[model samples]
Target: MHGKIPMASYDEAVASKLRRVSTDSLRFGIIALIAFLTLVDLFAAQAILPSLVVKFSVSRATMGFAVNASTFGMAIAGVAVALLGRNIDRRNGIWFSLVVLAIPTALLSITDSIAMFALLRVLQGLCMSAAFTLTIAYLAEHFSPGQAAGALAAYVTGNVASNFFGRILSAAVADGFGISINFLTFAALNIAGALLVWLTLKKTDRMMRIDADHPPVGGAWKAHFKNRELRGSFAIGFLILFVFIGTFTYVNFQLAAAPLALSPMALGLVYFVFLPSMLTTPLAGRVARRFGPANGIVLTLGIAIAGLLALLTPNLPIVLAGMALIAIGTFLAQAIATGHVSRVAARDKAAASGIYLASYYSGGLVGSFVLGQVYDRLGWTTCVVVLVAALIAATIIARPLTAPRV
Candidate 1:
């Protein structure tokens, strides 16, 4: 009888151990945290742009391009990873890329020339792309099919959260300590990201080693180019960021220089505008499902145009309201357009995404320079007019993104 009782206790203990080992909640948190660290440094530089201009003693346009040069490297890395990711080990690539990322982010503090600064920014972009690319792969491999959707949603929420909080942190650190120290703070976050991934993430046995039998990129792209919906999506993807980057980049100068005269900390807090976007963007897939991608694009970009017009208001509250609308509209539009790309490509979908991202970020790089010149020469109102025109063009391009008339 005693021996039988001991066996029952042993079985109960085993069952309890199995129950204790559930990692679903932990996995979601880890994925979101790592994504946040990966992208926290991306656009945070914009918060400190005024300080950087003073530090480098350079033109606003020059500083703007240098600050945005990260997009250039990101564009190249997106395509490279799409082609080469099958060979990369997701577990090691994510952690190691973050470690390397810290080096460039730290080095940014000591750079003295615009040329070098831009180069380091490019390096940062490369490391971030590798980490982000591999993380997406990791999610697909690690999570169950039932859990993958929620996991991806968590990762994207982290990215959006970083955009909102990262800038605030950067501005606060620069205001209190110094701009150089701000880079060091970000470097430390990079190290934390590496350690987090190293400790928690696991490798999957189901490796997607497909380079041995992959299709030719040149042939695939040619086919993708022939599709009208794909073509329209690619263009909309480009124009979305063109207007977004243009409006956000130059508006800082206007806010800091004139009647508003918001301090660095205050300007950083201005990104509170993204809160509505954070809330609204998660519903983008639902919006597309209900209204269809074509109508979703038109509806959201219409909100953006209304926001651009509101920027002409003389009142501060109205101006902030305008910025909030732009954030909500553009972010939702981007989510819709990105989802459209995934649907319309039909084959080599990863490569199609790579092409779309390259075009999207390239628009940001181009917008930084083009709109900087516009702001410097023609002033804020002309810049708003230019952005409004860009959004209008994007709306026209998105019209053909569907076959059935909407």
Candidate 2:
């Protein structure tokens, strides 16, 4: 028959190409390791929050300060990395950052004073921010357009998986061995991640060649911020992360009180809700490609709002279901928004990624403190209301993404 090649043949060809590219390039490995390390850092802090509070005799407000300190450091480091682009070898920057990150992470195990622990976390945040930004930039630069979304999704999956594993592992270890041991184990994981990056991840010499041709425009940041689509995407990222991190940070505290009275391990089970994100992120990307990022974002935000509202009901199963919905929505929003930023950024994909990430972490920092205080004063109902408000703001901002890119 004189017919065109079968669609299945095209699919096989694409899959074969992807396998070859992934095997030949070290970028995928680097992205995976960075994602792993970032999770380690995130979970190390989160897993220990309840234990730290008990050990140090600190209030939720103070714990919020600790969380803010780390995120604030991440924001600062993100800005610095953006400015330092091309001036430094991206590989060297990431490696140096890994070393810097290791010092503080390792020290967290030995530190007795809350002050010292917080300081270490802040330093860890700085190092991790730089490492993460560079790694993400490298992946975007190295991968082809066809593969970029999947690569980013894989990286994000690493992050979501780490969130699930980190908390569960830390809580389990804390239950059996001790909290200190849990921190130490995460520190070891960080070190291992660093080594994996250093050894297996190829130096980005070839990738740098690709990025070097697209030199930075002097005021690229200004140009990027001017894009309505990017601004909207960024806002969505900021708001969604603010609510997501804030809720996760304090969920343990909420559950530990009257009605639920869940143990640390039981509370850690909430992270299981996040597992769906790993499965949903790639699907979200496909949906975004078909329906457009704006539509995906709107749908996801609506789901998130519903999830937040469902928390108002006092049923545990309902609350868990709500949390799952929130996870799916958050991941969908993140995948869509991040893809939007990468596509619409004027120049310097790394810098754009840095800006987006900086906004994201800044929201976490601000939200952690602000929402924690809100919860302290007004209770869980007020906190849910705040999250719903943030989601509404996200929906408003996301509307701009539907506008023709200027």
Candidate 3:
């Protein structure tokens, strides 16, 4: 009787927390916008890569640097923010990151040299990592554990929004006016997002402070590495992104080739296949809470593998279906994995989140650069094989994370 009463009370407490987080529409919208603005510029670079290749008269391998540069910068920034950024207020950090991001995004328009373009991408990447890492850390810190997953899902949906429109809009604009205009348009949006963040979050900024009275802790690096669950989560983080980026980075080129050539705008539309991620990610928490995070992750990975296999088929509709499945699986798995990271670390959660983000973007860099080389040398078939292998590896690593709480 005693055990039953406490258990019921605990459940009620968690339910109340979840309801509160779900109802905070204004705060959720601002954070989601920050995530959207953070990633759009990077995806815009992906969309314009083909144009840059022609404009600079470079090989696909060389043109890939444009994409890799930002990812590499994001990886670096994740680590830096994890280690060095503990003292800054997250609300100010998020808006400031966007404000800084707009500078390089605006500069992307006029840069003629490939080297300079890549350099600007690197700068934008650094700013992007701050918003990406801090927003989720903020969510994790503010929401109750039971509610954190739902909040993270909302933020991640914003990420999916950027992924879908960033490339398509940029490609459409680049196809019509020029790549320069594409960059300029997104830059304007970035500035507007920054203003929105400041305006919306101004009143509540003090309430959301991550580490209020505690002195910033040290040894975060060693402590995070020592935690077994965290180690597994980081590995899962890396492999999932490695597979996701590897597939998408090269698909555009494949679609532009002889068999089923697509226009720039059409190529952008193809990314609509990824639109399902926006929906799947937000609902992922319900799935995780029902089944368990580890089980949910493995199930999503299996779905992703099936999608990759379907891509091996040459039929356009089949390929589109395959892309949709991959999107659903990838986002589902990522949402679970990311929310797990936020909940697992009790102290210096921001730094722990940073390590996970660092690994995640590091995987992206490898996927875009390393697998891109494989595509250049061997063929898309070999690239697909590599991505499948990586997903399987992630599933294996996630085996230890079966409990829903961890």
Candidate 3 clashing pairs? none
Per-residue lDDT value at 222 in model 3: 75
Q: Please provide TM-scores, in order, for all candidate models, with all chains considered together.
A: 0.91, 0.87, 0.87
Top candidate, metric TM-score: 1
lDDT of 1 at 173: 96
- In candidate 1, position 253 carries an lDDT of 85
Query: For candidate 2, lDDT tens digit of each residue in 1-406?
Result: 5345677788889999999886745555556557877656764456546777888888886876684577878888888877665555666677777776777776777787878877887888898788777777766666787677667767887777777777778777777777677767777777777776777656766433224456554567777788777777777888988988777777667666778767877766666877887688768768777777777798988988888888887678888888888888987888788878877875676667778888888888888888878878888889998899999889878775752355
Reference-based TM-score, model 2: 0.87
Better of 1 and 3 by TM-score: 1
Q: Give candidate 3's TM-score.
A: 0.87
RMSD of 2: 4.2
Q: Which is the winner by TM-score between candidate 1 and candidate 2? A: 1
User: Which runs of model 2 end up more than 4 angstroms from their true locations?
Assistant: 1-34, 206-218, 403-406
lDDT of 3 by residue, 1-406 (tens): 5999999999999999888666776566766776787788876666666677888787776777576678888989888877666566777888899999999999988988888888888898998887777766667667787667556656777789998988889889999998888888989988887887787654234333334454554566678799888999999999988888888777777777767678888888888887777877787778778877788899999999999998887788888888889989998898889878877886767677778988988888778888878988999999899999999999988888856343
For candidate 3, give the lDDT of residue 260.
Answer: 69
Q: After superposition, how far is residue 180 of candidate 2 from its true place, in Å?
A: 1.7
